[model samples]
Target: MNTFQFPMKMVKRQVYDRIAVQDQISKTELLQEMDITSSSLNRILDELVREGWISESGQGQSTGGRRPTLYRIDPTHRYILGLEISRVYSVLGLYDLQMNTIASYRWFMDEHMTPERLVDYVEERIDWMLNDYQLTWSQIIGIGIGAVGPLDREKGIILNPVYFPANGWKNVAICQMLNERTGLMAVLENGANTALIGEHWAVRDENMQHMLFVNVGAGIRSAMMSGGQLVRGAVDREGSIGQMIIQTDGERLHDQGNYGALEAFASVQALEQQVRQRMKLGMDIWEAAEDLRPEQVHFDTLITGLNQGNIFLQELFARSAGYMGIGLANIIHILLPEKVILGGALINANPSYYEQAIAVARKKVGYDDSYQPIFSKGVLQERAVAVGAAVMILQQMEL
Candidate 1:
């Protein structure tokens, strides 16, 4: 193959990507974004149309005389892999360039699911998915992983995520391992950041300039977007947002642990602990379910109790939501974002919990007299991280 052939091919892909993101683009827009001469760009566009990678989609409004033809990518012509890895479970999905979910699979994490086992599962699933879709390796854009942090995103490592079920997860080069197995390029990012990106894509038309995404579950995952760009840190410590000290004399995780961090108070694990401790101290959660062991006090059960009008659970969850609100207020005070999106199965399971968190946050922010931020539930919910992982591929500079 000619060395120039690769660069030319990449340029064509770049052309297709521009069209893909915009849904439709005209010659003028292409000319403005790309440095190529008009003739070269026309040639590329014509070649793309001939190759069936892109198509002429109607026409744009007339500028001076005749209208310009618009171009769009053939959405089905390519596929991307989106993966979200967390302490509880992982999601893998096949996505079109248009962000459609062609296929998806999920599995819960356990003590036995080490890095090697995870790769084994992913390799096998990708093989099956490709065969089922009747697609080949060459048609794939690449794999994107949205996972727990702190991560070494540049080096493609999962670093040290807290509360991981299995051992041997530290310093795992999962991106390289997946790339070696599937022979596709891979990009890794903090799950929270990916979820925020996914939310960005979901509301791209709105062009939200400032927003916060917080997933309140086993852990508190968070990411911020400001001025139409994600607020990234020098280190990909997404969970660090959870580690912010909320209580000066709160829970101590370890000797050096944060004294009442947001996660310490707002997370599902904390809720579960509180419930079990209360139950042990003669607080009856349910009359019939007296056998509810320490391990059995899950978010679902708590939500179920709330639905049944359990006052004890109502007060307990409300307190948790209040803490969550404090976390939101702290971030909102600094970023003063236009929107705050709350997600995670536990938070979404109860409408009252969502309301209370928003209420507490707004009350503390005290923006009612001035500029108040909007608060809403996460648009993508649990799938945000996984779908956002795929979106990250679209944003990959190399691609």
Candidate 2:
């Protein structure tokens, strides 16, 4: 929308990003941050307003004659579609420019939610939302996908990830499929990294130059950001955190073949298996809820058992929490981040698990009034990846 010749595209985007991140910013702040002349900034601001991306919010107190105009991203002019496709479930949200959700849908993954079926579901959801809002497709910018890894981000494809409920998940070009269906560009990113982006966006003013986000679910996923950029390994192995060796000869392993791993003892699957083994030994905690199969024993039942004061569950969860702490401690010693965010189904379902893990981590690190990173539960909860993917879509925008 910006047809200017003097102000470059990159510089214009830089200005837009600053305004979009902040709740509100003044003209003076923009001039100081951009280091550009008043005339150039004025031109860029006008273009963004005309493009319906940003607008003058209000007046800022002035040092001189007239008050300076404040700027903020326009909330309703444009929209972005963000999707989080994970092994456990998937979410779709339509967000405005300010990352506010307009309409959203979520579904648990089952044996039938294949890649093609997922695309169809996304298309139907988007159409339903557009009709409800009375907005046309032209107002929608593009799509952003935060999916489980290992992903070929360069190719916008979902690479092979284990333990998915459905078959035919290997090497799916999900980004392209969405683009073809919606007629908008699509960007692919690791769900964990997208969640990190989402958390960082929420805490952009906290001065956390080094931050780590770890998601614990059926598997462990992790992403780090340092100096405002994501820390990426050569391969897209966000789930590799699950494979971190917690013990050399502990004798347990994931079905995916990681021996003596933290996930073997701490993952939801591992906890379920442990609970089943205990039940076989005549443990009497099942009256808290329906007696489910080992494969069906998920966080819902576990949380119910925990609430019923099941002693066996308390001790078992304590051990799993301890393993989680050791894994986090190892990462902390290596990364030395300013903040560590813990999220996912397990942490979200059980508050005690989170508290215990953090306590163990602090003790393992020798808590002596030293510089320890602040550990937090992700405030965005399950929506982190989807909202983060939307933020990434905004970041990839061009003038």
Candidate 3:
């Protein structure tokens, strides 16, 4: 763990966390809370104010001599663009300096399975979104991209993204490319981390310092937050939990290198595959799914049937939830987050589907209500990653 001195990164984060609470914070209280001398803290606050990232909000009640000034982040001093890139769609949103979403747009692509298509798809949406908002490029302080990994954050590239090779984006420099194309600064991060940041910043819980971001969709990952900062351990490969072997002897594939992993059971592709395999056995899930739209399988139908007490669907979901529980239990034992926030399509399709899994996790975690970890759905819902990306830009400004 990195130690903190006065006028350092940790001190700044401490101040921001406090300011984040009351929408504004007083200087004396912050200095006292952070255990920093007034002179040093004032110097740092002055730098922050001069940067236009923070401003005086109001006068606080006088202690004895003079009333102290309250400071808050400049809500419109700058803006951030949060771009969430997925295999199916790209969601973009603009946020004021205070991490509030001002505008957003969702763009879908038929074939973003390659680097060129991926880049083009993002560039197009970014151009249209900025134009529609009538905001000059200069107003955008920074851009943050939430994407699938294993990624090269330094290089700003997705490294061999699974199932999307044709998009011409294997090792593609997403940050540099977007920076050059849009003339804005950019940071690339894991989708799970983005979602986690969204959840963390949204809850207004500065005290809930440690938590886990469990994304359950096309894949499953675990992003851990400890002591306020994200723990991207050892080369930014912290949350790649898709391949944790949950079953010793299950159907195996030579796909992403982990045999019979949780992804093989819980991912959207896995769910679709289960439906397809059931179809071969005289159970046509396509009919049960009630999918009419072209190229769009109705996952909601599966969820509906599971909710309405379809035995076969229930069994399928139970087993999938079991795998999810296995994954969650492993994460709980290892990282021990205070809470686990679930995100992604599979979880959103039917949160009930994962209830059995949570039960199983509870069994493994034993009983402890005081510091027990509770599982909850992400507050941002579908927009979690995008919003997190925007929040990332705001945080990067060191506000």
RMSD of each: 3.3, 2.6, 4.4
Model 2 alpha-carbon drift over 4 Å, by segment: 1-7, 23-26, 278-285, 288-293
Name the 10 consecutive residues with the lowest summed lDDT in model 2. Answer: 288-297
**Cα lDDT computed for each candidate against the true fold:** 0.84, 0.86, 0.75
Per-prediction backbone clash count = 0, 0, 8
Off by over 4 Å in 1: 1-18, 25-37, 58-68, 253-256, 397-399
Which sections of candidate 3 miss by over 4 Å?
A: 1-21, 30-51, 64-66, 112-114, 128-133, 233-239, 253-256, 286-311, 367-371
Query: How would you encode candidate 1's per-residue C-alpha lDDT over 284-323 as one tens digit per residue?
Result: 7777458877666666777777888878888888898898
Per-residue lDDT over 251-316 for candidate 3, one digit per residue giving the tens place of the 0 to 100 score:
643355477888888776677667656655655453445543323443555676677777777778
Give residue 285's lDDT in candidate 3 (0 to 100): 51
Report the Cα lDDT for candidate 1: 0.84
- Model 3 residue 390 CA deviation (Å) reads 2.5
Q: Pick the candidate with the highest TM-score.
A: 2
